[model samples]
Target chain A: MSERGKPNELGEYRPLSYFQLMEVSLRELLVEKGIVSDAEVQATLEDMRARGPDAGARVVARAWVDADFKARLLENGTRACEAFGLDVPALRLVVVENTPQVHNVIVCTLCSCYPRMLLGLPPDWYKSRHYRSRVVREPRTVLQEFGLRLPEAVQLRVHDSTADMRYLVLPMRPAGTAGWSEAQLASIVTRDCMIGVAVPDTSGSE
Target chain B: MPQVAARPQYPTDHPSVPVRFAAGDRVRVRKTFPLGHIRTPFYIRGHSGVIERYCGNFPVPEELAQMRSGLPAQPLYRVRFLQREVWPDYAGRADDVIEIEIFQHWLEAVKT
Candidate 1:
């Protein structure tokens, strides 16, 4: 019933990659084995599709406004995320706070195991070989290419997501945004900021 | 069917293999490339650093990736390495550093 790839000469569409074929075959086998229903798989796919950077932005905005919530978030990221009704099951979420002295950046050099439940699928650059290999080695240059120039005094700490855990950067709140509402604040906290490539823009530009 | 979720706490208290290093302990990553799925990056191999914190015990990813029961969870630690040590030609501030979560099996104690 899918309309994705072009039809083959035999009037049947084929999967593009072996992985795709394997996934389809596995799904069919699981359904046939009564392990999982097609409806359940479809619903899970829908849930994944609904997730995006907005969820992360909302969490960041709340942390910026609520001091108590921020403490809880820093202590236990997975538990605090539940306050926003975001349940990150299966994986541990580690939130590294970006302070005036310490700047935090994240990378998964082995594979793209990101916090997809909160931030959705990672950007292409996050999964790119160049970004993965270079970020850990030359974080300053990589961040600079992304237009983030850090002060000489600030220490850049790159966290490599290489285990069963995922990381999210708790970027410092931008200055000159005193008494701003959570919604207004969330609007400027871009996805790259949470990933630690950039900072929240106080200029209010999208 | 409900999604298969991983338990939050993997059994960490393995009696045979006690956690060797603690937070603030100096350590070095063993430079070895076992033939399997490894979570440790190549850059950190054979590098020296201080254990920033004890992350927790988790199933060995190498076995887990192959659908095998990676039992007897190993202690995972966040090791902090100086940027200059990691890359001699690193152009960032001398104070810059990187923290990597490496498993105990891949780490060896440094007497510093």
Candidate 2:
């Protein structure tokens, strides 16, 4: 279980951080102690991998098509998501609406607390120190870095996902998307759009 | 295998402590730096804001993070603060705001 100071074929040794070493020790102890089986860990990994932006896209697309569903989602996010067969577990999900005048962005300053059941693993940049620190102070500038330039009139609202609750931004439906099918609309909703960094390009669907 | 008891569920409607603030209430975040894991960010500490919504009552994360019984659930509120207020040199528009979910323990009602 101890890989620290282990020499490689190239006669080079790489040291693991205290946190990494503790993680390895704890994991091995758990497996050896029969608390968590290797197969169970693999299954959990597979489950996490199976979820992605596609699920979030489906929810957003459904909300766009059904006003009642959108209301439920805004009112009770976790329950509404369960209607779509998404398991929310003990964590509560809050869906913030992006209106014509207000845009929403999500960040976790303390740690990468995200809606993994819906959005999958957050992008590397989302977990970076720069994104966590800068997004709250200068959201507009951060959004601009993502190539999303909002009009001056649109107010920027950054949601700091700090607690046990998870947040998902329900971006405003793009113009000219009228009469668009749910599947068609879902295809245009990228991960960045749901994260509030980018907007769905409606012209592509047309 | 030890028989595990059903875990306690802390619902939003039922809070262990008395909720002093509600949505639209003016509140100021406490500036205390308690040891162990905390959800309150440093930037928001000692800052004033308005409660945007009542998120729900849940286990106090500070205790939960230490693997202790997060008993006596605390109310969590979504507080909205202007970016300019949070940062002195905030380059964003004055109208821009950031919302953070904070526990009841870290907030005090502002004397409006």
User: Which of the numbered candidates is closest to the native, going by highest lDDT?
Assistant: 2
lDDT of 2 by residue, A1-206 (tens): 33455876788888887987887788889999999987887788788777788988999999999999999998878889898787768658889999988999999999899888788889999999999998898788889999999899998999999887788899888888888899999999989998899988977657
Candidate 1 lDDT score at position A119? 90
lDDT for A195 (candidate 1): 91
Judged by whole-model lDDT over C-alpha atoms, candidate 1 comes out at: 0.83
At residue A130, give the lDDT of candidate 2. 99
Complex DockQ, candidate 2: 0.47
User: Which portions of model 1 miss their true places by more than 4 Å?
Assistant: A1-4, A7-15, B1-16
- Fnat for each predicted structure, in order: 0.81, 0.75
Candidate 2 B-chain TM-score: 0.86
TM-score of each: 0.88, 0.90
lDDT of 2 at A4: 59
- For candidate 2, the TM-score is 0.90
Positional deviation of A135 in candidate 2, in angstroms?
Answer: 0.6
- Candidate 2: pairs in clash: none
Could you say which candidate leads in TM-score?
2
